[model samples]
Target: MTAVRVLLADDEHLIRGALAALLALEDDLVVVAEAASGAEALAMARAHRPDVAVLDLQMPGGPDGVKVATSLRDELPSCRTMIVTSHGRPGHLKRALSAGVRGFVPKTVSAQRLAEIIRAVHAGNRYVDPELAADAISAGDSPLTAREAEVLEFAADGAPIAEIAERASLSQGTVRNYLSAAAAKLGAENRHTAVRLARERGWV
Candidate 1:
C-alpha cells in the first residue's frame, strides 16, 4: 500500500518535534515537510503538495491557519487540512470550518488521537475534538453581529466609547448600542465583562 504524504506546520520547535516523532510511528504515514511559520507552511504546501497538511492555528504570517487551509483548498484541492492548536476557541472552529479544514484537534489531545484524526482527514472524513465540539455547539447559541464584534475588540484594547465610535465610524449612541447588544448576548452585565468574555472566546 502507498504511504500517505503529510506536512507539519507549527511555531514551537519542541511541539513540532514531538508531533513529528509521533506521526513517524504510524506505518501508513510519511512526514514530507515541516514548517515553523504560516508563511513557511504555505510555501511548503505549494512545494510538496502533500496528501495532508497539519497546521497550527496561530503562526507568523499575514493570515493564520484558516487562511492557509482555504488557500490550499482552492489551489490544491487534493491536499487535506487539519488544524492542531492549544486554542479551542469557538470562533477559531467557526472560521476553520468555513475555510474547509477537515479536522480540528487541540494540543491537549493524546498523540494517538491526533494521529487517528490526521489519518481520518486524509481518508476524506471530518474530525472535531469532542470537548471543542460541545463548546462550539454551545457557542453557536449566542451570536454576535460583525459590528458588535468590532466594537468589543476595540473596547477590549482599552478604547473608550468615543474612541471606539470613531474607529468604527459609528455614532456614540450606535457604539453604545453595539456594546450593549454584545453584553446582552454574552449575558454579561457590563461592557468590560463583555470584552473580557469575547477576548477569552477569540471573538475579537
Candidate 2:
C-alpha cells in the first residue's frame, strides 16, 4: 500500500516532535513535512503538497488553522485539511467545518485515533468529535456581524481605537461603532467585557 503523505504543523516543539514520532510508527502513513508556525505551514504545504495536513488550531505568526484550511481549499484543493485543537470551542469547530476542514478533533485523541481520522478524511469522509458537534449545536450561531467580529478580534489585545482603526483600515469612529454594537449584542458593559464574553463563546 502507498503510504499517505502527511504534513504536521504545530508551534510547540515537543508536541510536534512527539506526534511526528508516534505517526512514524504507522505503516501506511508518512509525515512529509513539519512546521512550527502557520506561515511555515503554508510554505511547507506548497513545497511538499502532502495528501493531508494536520494543523494546530492556534498557530502563531500567521494564519490560524482555519485560515490555512481556507487557503488550501483555494490553492491546493487536492490536499485534505484537519485541525487538532486543545481548545475545541464550539465556534472554532463551526469555523473549521466552514473552512473545508475534513476533520476536527480535540488534542486529547490518541495517535491511533488521529491516524484513523486522517485515513477517513483522505477517503473524502468528514469527522467531528461528537461532544464538540453537540456543543456547537447548542451554542447557536454567532450574533456578531462579520465586520464586528473582525473589529473585536483587533480589540482582543486591548489595542486602542486608533490602532484598531489603522489595522482594520476604518475610521476611529467606525471602529467605536462596531465595538459598541458588538458589546451590546453580547450584553457586555464594555468592549473588554464583550471581548471576554465573545471569547468564552468562541464568537470572536
Candidate 3:
C-alpha cells in the first residue's frame, strides 16, 4: 500500500515530537518531513512534495500557519494543509478557512482522531473541530474595523503608539485614533482594557 506522505511543523519541540511519533505508528501514514517553524515547513514542503502539511497555528521566526497554508494553496496545490492549534478562538478558524486550508483541528484531540482528519483532508474534504465550527457560526462579526483591530493588537503586546504606527505604516495620530475608536466600540476604559476585551472575545 502507498502510505500518505505527510509534513509536520511546530515550534514547540515536545508537542511536535510527540504528534510525529503517534502519526508514525499509523500503517497508512508516513511522516516524510518535520520542521520547527513555518519557514522550515515551506522549504521542506518544496523538497518533499508531501501529500498533507500539518502545521501549528503560531510559530517563531517565520510566517504563521495561516500564511503558510495560504502560500501552499498556490505553491503546492497538490498538497492539502491542516492547522492544529491550542487556541480555541473562532476568528482563527474563519481566517484559516478563507486561506484555503483543508483542516482546522485542536491539539486537544486524540492522536487517532487527528490521523483520521488528516486522511479525510488529504482525500479532498475539509474538516474542522466541531466545537470550533459551532463557535464560528455563533460569533457575530467583529465590532472593530480591520485597522482598529490592527492597532489594538499591538497594544495587546504593550507597544507604544509610535511603535505601532511604525509597524503598521500609519501616522501616530492615525494609530491613536484607531486605538480610541476601538476602546469606545468595545466599551473599554483604556487601551489595555480594550485589548483585553477584544482578546477575550477572540477578535484579536
Candidate 4:
C-alpha cells in the first residue's frame, strides 16, 4: 500500500518536531515536508506535492492556515488541507470551512487522533471539533466589513489614530469612520470594546 505523504507547518519548533516524530511512527503515513511559516508551507507544498497539508492556524509573517488552505484549493486541489490550532475561535472555524479545509482540530488532540483525522481527510471526509462547531453555530456571522475588520486589527494594540491610519494606508478620518462603524455594528460603546468583542469572536 502507498503511504500518505504529509506536510506539517507550524511556527512552534518543539511542537512541530514532536508531531513530526510521532507521525513518522505511523505505518501508512510519511512526513514529506516541514515548514515554520505560512509562506514556507506554501512553497513546501508546491515542491513536495504532499497528499495532505497539516497547518498551524496562526503562523506568523504570512497568511494564516485558512488563507493557505484557500490558496492550496486553487493551486493544488488534490492536496487535502487541515488546521491544528492552539487557539480555536468560532469565526476561524467558519473561515476554515469556507476555505475548503477538510479537518479542523485543536492542538490538544493526541497524535493518534490526529493521524486518524489525516486519514479521514485524505479520504475526503470533513471533521471539526464538536465544541468549536457548537460555538461557531452560536457566535453567528460577523457584521463588520473587511475594511472595518482590518482597521480594528490595526487598533488592537491600542495604537493612536494617526499610527493606525499610517499602518492601514488610510486617512485619520477614514480610520475613525471604520472604527466607529465597527463599534456600532458590534454594539460596542467604543473602539476598544469593539476590538475586544471582535477578537473574542475571532472576527479580526
The 10-residue segment with the lowest total lDDT in model 1: 134-143
- Please provide the root mean square deviation of candidate 4 (C-alpha atoms, Å): 1.9
Better of 3 and 4 by TM-score: 4
What's the number of clashes in each of the models? 0, 0, 0, 0
Candidate 4 structure quality by residue, lDDT tens digits, 110-148? 999999999999999999989888988898989989999
Task: Report the CA-based lDDT of candidate 1 relative to the real structure.
Answer: 0.88
Q: State the lDDT of candidate 1 residue by residue for 1-204, as single tens digits.
A: 898999999988998988899989998888999999888888999999999999999987566888889999998999999998887998788889989999998899888888888889988999988889888787664479888888888888778889999988889999999999999998899999998888667677
**Alpha-carbon local distance difference test for all models:** 0.88, 0.95, 0.92, 0.95
Candidate number that wins on TM-score, 1 or 2? 1
- In model 2, which regions exceed 4 Å deviation? 159-178
lDDT of 3 by residue, 116-162 (tens): 99999989999999999988788766889989998888878888888
Worst 10 residues of 2 by lDDT: 195-204
**Pairs that collide, model 1:** none
Which RMSD values do the candidates have, in order? 1.7, 2.3, 2.1, 1.9
Task: Give the Å shift of residue 122 in candidate 4.
Answer: 0.3
Q: Which candidate do you rate higher for lDDT, 3 or 4?
A: 4
The CA lDDT at 6 in model 3 is 97
> Mind sharing the TM-score for model 1?
0.91
